[model samples]
Structure formats: C-alpha cells, structure tokens
Target: MLSDVFGDPATIDETAHLVGEVRLIRTVSRAEAQRTTRFVRHGRA
Candidate 1:
C-alpha cells in the first residue's frame, strides 16, 4: 500500500491497528497531496 509505504511509522501503525489491513491508493501527485493535507486541516477540498 502506498500509505503503508509512505506514511509515518506511527500513522502506519495506528492505521493498521484500526483497519486490520493497510490498503492505500497508489500514485498521487504533489498537488494532490498538498490539497489533501489542506483539506484535512481546513475541512475544505
């Protein structure tokens, strides 16, 4: 999983604990990542 590969160790562990499996979307653009972070923090996409 891309998240499993790219996520911070703590985030990966927490997600694994909750989800039981790590499934992640592959190949996101830098702009997309930045947009996602902004949306997550600001609640607007």
Candidate 2:
C-alpha cells in the first residue's frame, strides 16, 4: 500500500517520504490555487 509505505507518522524516514508526497501535491495544486489565491514564489528561480 503506497499510503502505508508513505503515511507512517513515527519515523523520520516516513516523515521525509510524506513531505515529498505533500510537495508533489502542492506543485500540482498550485495552478488551481492560483486561480483564486495569491502566492509568493520564493527560492531558487
């Protein structure tokens, strides 16, 4: 189960995995979010 592999909340490895998953989702949702919200793009550009 991908969620089981990535959703454990007690290990650093699991936290890192979950963060990566969250980043991917955030990147995908940025466009939609942009339609109604403003965001600051910071970091290596």
* lDDT leader: 2
TM-score of each: 0.32, 0.45
**Per-residue lDDT of 1-45 in model 2, one digit per residue for the tens?**
656665655565768878999999998898767744543354322
Q: Write model 1 residue lDDT over 1-45, tens digit each, in one string.
A: 767675877887786766653232323455679889989899776
Candidate 2 lDDT (Cα, whole model)?
0.70
Q: What is the alpha-carbon lDDT of model 1 when measured against the actual structure? A: 0.67
Q: What is each predicted model's overall lDDT from 0 to 1?
A: 0.67, 0.70
Which ten-residue region of model 1 has the weakest summed lDDT?
20-29
**Superposed model 1: Cα runs more than 4 Å off:** 1-28
**Which one is best on TM-score?**
2
Error of 2 at 30 (Å): 1.0
